[model samples]
Target: MSTEISIKDAAKQLNISEQRVRTLCRQGELESRKFGNSWIINAESIDKYGLRTAHMVAEDHPAYNVNEKCKKPIALSFFSGAMGLDLGIEKSGFDVRLACEVDKYCRQTIALNKPDTALLTDINKYSANEVRLAAGLGKDEEIDLIMGGPPCQAFSTAGKRKGLNDERGNVFLKYIDLALELRPKYFVIENVRGLLSCPMEHRPHEKRGDDYPELGLDELKGGALNFIINRLENSGYSYSFNLYNSANFGTPQIRERVIIICSRDGVKPPYLVPTHSEFGSDGLQKWNTVKKAISNLTSHDHLTFPEKRLKYYRMLSAGQNWKNLPIETQKEAMGKSFYSGGGKTGFLRRLGWDKPSPTLVTHPAMPATDLAHPVEDRPLSVQEYKRIQEFPDSWDLAGPIIQQYKQVGNAVPISMGNAVGKLIMNLLKGNEIPSFNNFKYSRYKNTSDKEWKEQFSKQVLKHKESTEQKELGFG
Candidate 1:
């Protein structure tokens, strides 16, 4: 038997769309056979076609001009998982000189794609000068930008919400210190929407009730984000941040993240303009949907649902969840979680082909966050995850199957990254950015940069007032 790979993998390896691969098979440009509802592609045919892999640039390629783009701004990336953000920055014409990551697999993935680029293993171990040297930058060189999404689980609502108390959260502060040390002209920080609401101190689970007594003033209403803003302001940097839904920026997923852009010169950064709208309002294209993103995929390899859960999945249709099943069946499927307070939407959930996918979780088979395919009984395939995250088809994730899912799921959507890149480019070029009025930044509206700053100021003032009162023995 000849060596073979699934059509989805073949598409990824060949750096082409899955539909294009099928077209090649139909035109006898490649050899393939049907396996159930999927296609098995001949690995030998892929090699014979001389298709260039993703991230590999031949010196003779038309896109290759070593000296023409030498003036591109330089960037240093921290917590660069799979380089999704870096890729976006690079696409926007920034030269990513180095990336810092601690995960072995992520480091492998980065090294695989960016062999020449310096990969710093641990942020804590390296000094600012060391990072600069690793990136081949001299001490006198001006670092144009530093960007990354520090670990967000500490602030993620789904997690412990430890804020600055958690060691990972401390790393977030360290990231800020590093940026200050490097004194880059600009810096970018990205995190989950949960960061907006995460309190500086984690409230005890037993005391989480609405009727619980109000906390002291030091425990302000705004979360760690306020502290971050205060630090930046005091450090003489001006910043703007807003929550953004990736769908608004042409990604095929409804993932939301808080993007904070800062400038060392104390000038407020402009907002990122959305290129797509939910209903095609504002003269933008309607948000891309899951169907459009993966309809052409002829093969998939996904995590298997247990036979027990598979039965319920078989009964559900696209856009249907446990709620769509019969009352008796719903109870049977949900078990103890059925009586829980929340919507329990993820239980027995099937994606809607027309809708953008819900945020991709690290695991698709979790009880509370299942991401079952719309019609298929199984979870989304690894290839589908890559597509939804906007990672190039040929980008190789270095890990086991489960680890691959986690890497892709945790990535910032490539489209969102590209949008950030564009914003940075515009700022660098000193171009005036166009504005959108009445823009909905995330699922929640009114999260504009101005509104966020106003809210943050209020919380900071409250904290200061409380501190002064305590000093005067008025506590």
Candidate 2:
């Protein structure tokens, strides 16, 4: 029942000690049940259990419990959000001994799910030696990997794309330096797809046309990543990267992320091998769908939409958006955004049953990016978000429900994590796993390390030739 509460919460509501509440449960004055040792105060005992509890006790602390006696490969994680990527690596036979995160909610999540793993804050504040010590590695124990998806808002396409100029982007650069300093056998950097095209030094669009000199290398698109690659090359590391669709790796959501796998060893690892594909091409499985992900759910915890929005939702069918409504209704539903440019596909939209769900956003009910359920009159629930992200059904997220959604939404899909792990594992075992030829890694073009380098070279050459023409009166 929804009214079921936790004993800790019951103690607060009933104004009694948690011990007193436990005694009541023992004396049969209250009805309580257990899920992994945490108690759930039953709905039947409304006076004692009350409505504060949501019927689930989150004894999910040991979710990623590891055996200390067994020494798998060692890894250090930074900017670790919800440990989604770390879990994938852990499952791939790595002992993830340390995780560094700055978000308070994420720290709580890490403490809950990985009690034994060392937790740190602010990647910028810690030295490489401090990080190694925090991970509990003895002086001679070498690290196999260092991984992070640094705060990516600087390179997010939705933002102004400040790239390395932004403070957050500077921190990303710091993570890179740390990796090199620590000298892990391999290092992985996961980031938003926008990183592929972001310039190292952004120039305002208004400073363009004949008014500006030919854009320097730092100002050109893809310059930021080029700079990062150059930094690694100067340090003697080889890398391979690609923009990968999470759906291609068996995730139910169609989120695309850029994964850069680097090595202290000379040879670079291949692109992540796919476990699924669109249309099930190349003998891979078909893309997982949201309908397949949540069809059996009988109950869900969720945030609600306003009645005004619900009325329009009732008029629309699964897969329909504001465009599906009557012309007048569409205008009303979209308001001024109806007249805006680009197909506002997210406005007043309902998810399609057959298709992979859209990229999960931190907030599902934001006007321009609604993520309503296909049949229900609400946005995708936090539980649904976790399932789509491939977190286990019982993985207890920390923070309030809204914060919970943010944590899950921002997570790297676990399937993608597993693929990253598998690739690293193969490399460590001296297995060279080449990717399937001609496979589409993502919707974008020229994003692979090979393809992107060629493109960057061409862009640089074009700029060089143009500058020469201006100098020699060949223009």
Candidate 3:
């Protein structure tokens, strides 16, 4: 399986000392043969040992690069929360050279995991020179990709639909600025689906006896995403934006996101291919259930509830809600909420043992959106949240147990991250058409709540000397 070469030749090829080569061979990190007067090593053995040689291939296999067969591409990530997306992309073969984030806990999480990686606090404060330095490259180093999901609350369905003026919306714009400044070969913009309909400006009302502003959808010029696309196109980047269902990409949760991909070189727009289907014929693959993600986690002993909330979720069977309870019991449990008209689906709900989990929120045990466990009377545990989000068991999350739950709950799932990373890799490799026939987001059974006070206390104690925490007012 390996070509035979002399020890001196192998050392010369690998650009290392013969002593080092011999040491590696002695330790079995590399294999060699001794024939009468000389030592010979196999080419395959050199490759297996990842020894860098001038003539032979010293880099990773072409198939291993997600960019398909192109040269190894480097990346820079922003708003890198717990680095779930970055982790997946790195696994898929893109070299993430540097990361940017503002949250203290998230920064801690990134430091804990990727200690060797260069991490900066804020994208706004980062300069091109600093970025180059952090990447350990010169100013002319080729940056293949820049990816990020700016906070979407400003463009979320629940927030005020203020487009570019909202501070958070400006942050998204800042990400655009960075992209233009860096001019990476590829760029990604991620946000909530509400960006499709969020208004740019409020319509003015006709002059009346008393002056007051009138608001209507027709009065707005366009959605936030329209402006975003226009800006990207104007910057000389050919781009495409679409709504992607995370379920289609192997995440158990049915989370949908608006993702935009842009390229500076005017290449074909990359579309992610799903690799798993919930109800497909292959049968070798199926949508992962909540149980599959979390069944292995040990249950927590204490059933802690949020502060000042005497109400706790009453355990129920699968596919059952508050309506399943005795009529009198329902009325007593729901109180005034029972008298309300709309479908109060959150009341007394239990996750099915076989389905995917619903969208996880900051607090899982809120009365209006109760996510009680099927068998247990309490909410889901902190470890369970990480599993549902596809975070590795060995991954360490910072902050108190409650804050950790909140951070993980708000993250993009790792399975979906992996799919996106692979797609980006394909783009880097010049794969024009990628297969995505298998993505599906299936529903499953899944819960959490501890009080803000307790979580804050724990965070303060946990990061008493954190400089970023003090600067960000998180202290």
Candidate 4:
């Protein structure tokens, strides 16, 4: 005849330490009765105590809103890898109805943190109506926002740069198709900075002989982006896109990505407001540093450099890379890589505590993209990566160690996601954003939409001119 919860569940529901819960029970501050060594906390007592603890614990926990009514403007996330973007959007007060992801590891992570949210594994298998139903939406109901970053390897400069010709690139196109079908009021598509300059057709390295011919003059320099824009325009949506550095928005890393914001009613998309600046100019705070982000951590597991690389890391100081070593030592350490072109800054690099971390790579041990710790002899740990990406301490990321690294490395920094979410919320509410024309949004300033288009035109024209001459057999 008695309804009660075990002490553990009470602590969990109250968002407090179990010891604190037990102490309260012992003191009779909480309405509970002890059953031998175990405490039988009255269910009513938990409800009463939760109200008081909810306010105090809400700042650091997600369970505080258990009894609150659901907010409006629901979102459906596609390609929701580890839900970093979804987390940011949720923080902005939007309810995420469902998430679609395909990667097994990423799906596990999402399922672990977002147990209540419906998750679909293969997007290709579901129609928009099916997805809506899966999200617990009525067939006639409209989704307020759709957002995701499709797999970006096809457009990544670090990869083969296959653009739309690659199967993954085709999947990017499918996401756009799904967005059109869903008819969301607003949609955001994010991708790598390389997408800004990717050509429509894959251009093989010229040294591979004349097997691959030059592309025609009519080809756009950023073929994939232009195609996406054309498709959205034809579907009666207006959009604006810009390359953003995550550090500009308060994340502690210098990760850059392209975000395209589209509105169904053809309204011009507003730019993301900057919260930090590189040097504290324009009334903004200085960029958060890696030291501030992860320096307080006690010992945790991390990937270590092989002894061969550790030998070189030992000789470097904070902020120094392979280039900082004595010239003879650099040669001795780098061997063949010493003569390689490009900055090669990632080689034997030790991060500086005062500056934002260089963009995180999927694997930190690669010679070309090493992310060795500032004073430690190992790569940044999974915990450090989470902090750098601005993921909450309590957010669970489920996977093996390597998979965890990929999930964190590939995430859109939560701060950047929050900025995007805020812009969408403002648009939804018809709020006029204050202009800060003088503000710098990144270490490299954001390129205006017009400026980007003009630059693209010039690059395409330049390439066309060169290609035409080659067709005429005139150098």
Candidate 5:
């Protein structure tokens, strides 16, 4: 016997009702033997017949509280760093009743922002029961969606690409487990693009030799994404995943992420089509420009500029890098980097007055990756960073000024979140999908705000100028 389970246990384990499990047993969808007056199922049969859906496990079935109407769905957030994703989801139109995050700083941040929603201290210490209590629903309530992107450090291209074996990578797996336990209708897993090509370990053959590489402290013995997908499929869900650029979804910065959508319902998995394009074509809109995002804000004193560096950037023009500097000044200002290989593009780089900004990393003043204001001579301040990233002015971030800058810079843009939120709302409401595949927002619909109209119109004019320049073949 390979860990036999009762038929009722099988039903609970698979996140379905006992009545359905009994039917499966009768119809040969499940394997069960009579024990006492009831049927008992073995682990093998459980694996064979059970469906593993995202966000809900067999244990979570008891905690489900949704009725057949599937009214308001509760969300369970995992690896909830700074709650950027959660904020976007909420803004778009879902209720986030509970969140699980491990970092003390992030937790404090969450508490500051959303004091009423139940938040778990550590993801590992939480179970489905805890989630239900926090969500203010019973085990029988159906959680509509489970969402989160575990910390992306281990899976990022900038990092070692350690995949599932990294301790941080294990949190990704734990997210899957919670989804299965909760049996939510859908789940969204967000990660970096590197997950598509991360090298993973093969499932070991029972009798095979043990020459595998040393696994990390809590890393799983398989490729991170693959292991996560396999477990979800085994538990009974269909998943669709792809990489998307934040700029395409109205974010001012050029950031890309891989979004994985999973569902238990046997339907086409929802995919997010691009809503903003770099260049308009076939009625698609161009990407949002950095100027459109932050041009209006009055310049506050920048946070990082020492007196000397600040004076230097003041001399540069928007869209000009060190290459535009006088040859003598370039050598003197750039120092060793002037002789370095590859495009030291960031050296003295200034944002183009008409184009979207590059990704904002933790530090803006980093050599070879300067993010100086187009007109000002210094790196952007915390307020400006938040404005560019689309975070509300009222949203509070906890930390020192630099720490605040880092957190805000690391955040997913609010506009991108809004886009994702709209799509999610449409999906949950069973409405016709919005025009996501099409990218230009300017021509879609007119807004009534005079200032917004003026701002957006100005960018259109600048974009037209750039287009004409391209037509003339100007560099």
Candidate 6:
């Protein structure tokens, strides 16, 4: 239900006159309803109007500033969306001294929440020395850690799968170059699960078939990661990476990411320790559920689905989706999509009160990836998105409501960040690292560096053998 307040309340909230509020209502600048003659405004409309009409809430502070009093190990952040990962590291005692973000709203978010951290706009415009100085360090001051995930669209399965050939891919290399130049004692890189299989060189689909020649080394799946490993290795950095699900670290979402850790001293930190597990197995806590994540909220502000989609949502219960619809209803609801392949599980789905949410998408109402609330008629709220990502409720998110959702959706789960941060502390402090062997970080196999490399080597050997037999006409 929409929250409504009198015009006087709306005017007071915006610090504008009653006449101006009514003018906005008449102009359709705010959402207003006339009940028996008096105008009542939607409370959310007031907030949105205030945010756009005047200087943003983020304008209260400087865009960037350095903290001279920071005493924790220094971490420099890049591609710092909402500082979700950095927050986790901070929990484990590292100070993120600088944040470099390119997005406008993300910069606003950084300035709003991390006023003390120096903020830079474009990484490409700065040199190693510039980045260091901005972090409040001297020319030769050692960097404790450099952490970021460069844009992953180049390697994302959902995109063109361009790998490092795209312009964004070049930036990915530059981030590593910056790390190598600054020579941080430790660094962390995080990305989507698809990076494991993206090729170093992407070949267009039309160019491949039975008539095409055998795949080149650089064109094979895993080639992209192999090239990254080689580049870091050549730079004298020893790295370890694995696919990990955020839920294992106690995040209330089943989001998986590839985390790569590189050490200047060649000391490898073990994989992240799991704080919870599916079904409470191995004596860990049970996975955090959507019900638990949002149960404390007294009210929710959310976007709504069209009446057509709502018809399907109303038919389904918690944890149910289009699969639960009757046969004819399924066809009507899905239309052409009903006959298309795959589970179509994301269609008209509702979150399960007893289960963790599916991965949070940038847009919660996308047809193929809706993240509806368990019992509500609307999609999950921005407040609920923050909670599931493990961000503190008071952590200010600045921007339009849609942009707020994108920011929260793209953040590294605070639990995942905390895990990485705790591990980094142990490694840097000379404590014995916790080791869990054969742990199912995700549902995939051969994802560890050791196993993945071995498997790739086998593929290369198999290709070579097949080529030799083909040339020799063994058949």
lDDT of 1 by residue, 339-456 (tens): 8898888777788999899999889998789999889888999899988888988886766678788888889998898999899789888998999977887888557667876776
Cα RMSD of predicted structure 2: 5.9
Q: Where is model 6 poorest over a 10-residue stretch in terms of lDDT?
A: 54-63
Q: Which residue pairs does candidate 2 place in steric collision? A: 5-53
Candidate 2 structure quality by residue, lDDT tens digits, 255-319: 99999999888887789999999999999999999999988877688888989899999998899
> Comparing candidate 1 with candidate 5, which one achieves the higher lDDT?
1
* Candidate 6 structure lDDT: 0.85
Once model 1 is optimally superposed onto the true structure by TM-score, how far is the C-alpha of residue 470 displaced, in angstroms?
A: 10
Instruction: Tell me the whole-model lDDT of each prediction, alpha carbons only.
Output: 0.82, 0.85, 0.67, 0.81, 0.68, 0.85
* Candidate 6: residue 320 lDDT (0-100): 94
**CA error at residue 125 for candidate 6, angstroms:** 0.9
The list of candidate 4 runs beyond 4 A from truth reads: 1-69, 207-214, 217-220, 442-446, 459-475
Task: Answer with 3 or 5, whichever has the higher TM-score.
Answer: 3
Per-residue accuracy of model 4 over 292-401 as CA lDDT, tens digit each: 99999785657889999999899988899989889999999899988878888888988899999999988888888999889989998988989899898776665567
Clashing pairs for model 1 are none
Task: Write down the TM-score of every candidate.
Answer: 0.82, 0.87, 0.71, 0.82, 0.70, 0.87
Backbone clashes in each candidate structure, one number apiece?
0, 1, 17, 0, 33, 0
Please report the TM-score between candidate 4 and the true structure. Answer: 0.82
In terms of lDDT, the poorest run of 10 residues in model 5 is 52-61
Which regions of candidate 3 deviate over 4 angstroms? 1-71, 202-222, 281-284, 299-303, 306-315, 435-475
For every candidate in turn, the CA RMSD to the true structure comes to 8.7, 5.9, 15.8, 7.7, 20.7, 6.6
Candidate that beats the other on lDDT, 5 or 6, i.e. the better one: 6
Clashes of 5: 33
Against the true structure, candidate 1 reaches a TM-score of 0.82
Better of 3 and 5 by lDDT: 5
